[model samples]
Target: MKNTLKNKDISQTPFRRDVLKIFNSHKNAIPLSVIEQELSSYNRVTLYRTIKSFIEKNIIHEIVISGEESKYALSKENKDTPYQQHIHFKCRSCNILFCSELDKAITISLEKHKIERLDIQAFGICNKCNIS
Candidate 1:
């Protein structure tokens, strides 16, 4: 049940429940645009506000890709929550998301910056998605 219902601190936002619901269905990250499209009830302002809160609270982290759209996934390891931080990989062809091993995670910050949190996303074709 822990994985099912992630403890959320959303006192500041009204549409917070809707925003948290976004991560419940998918195993991978979804773009803000896509999430907006999926949850049509909340208006743009609410979505943006909720996203901002989530980012600030470390509930979600941004996924960076070269040509792909910006994506966001839950940061279970965030201080606000008990979830553990894990890296992700998105396939170009199949678009499937995989949770990479934390020990195997390649990103390592040598120096501490002003950044509050960091997550690494490596993009490429997975073994099954690879073309022969």
Candidate 2:
């Protein structure tokens, strides 16, 4: 089966489709390890580089939780394509990166200039992983 999701070389990697599946299924945040486990066959370096490419392409964004490690999740733009502009959240304890809707959570309007690349991140305890 051909992967309609255009992230990488779809012709070669069927497992890559699982990565996109996460975006479709979960509205919450996810980390690289979670992604790796979901995809199954993907290796460490390959997954890492694949994630790096996703970040570069704006298919997914990275997050660095304050006092914790980093995580990655999909962007929230409805185009279903790479828009390269959106906000994210990071859980301090879990280090999970969540793709949040900027317009809803935090109203942001740039003066005159259009927002080409958006990387808004909030680091704290997430609702599910809150330590308190």
lDDT of 2 by residue, 53-82 (tens): 666666666677666456666654434644
The sequence of per-residue lDDT tens digits that candidate 1 reaches over residues 1-132 is 323223455573446766677776677778887788777676788678777878887777777677877788776665554444466888888887656547642444567655445566777888886755
Q: Scored by CA lDDT, what does every candidate get?
A: 0.69, 0.61
Off by over 4 Å in 2: 1-4, 7-12, 78-97, 104-120, 123-132
| Model 1: pairs clashing at backbone N, Cα or C within 3 Å | 76-83, 77-83, 77-84
Off by over 4 Å in 1: 2-9, 12-14, 80-85, 104-119, 127-132
What value does the lDDT take at residue 26 in candidate 1? 71
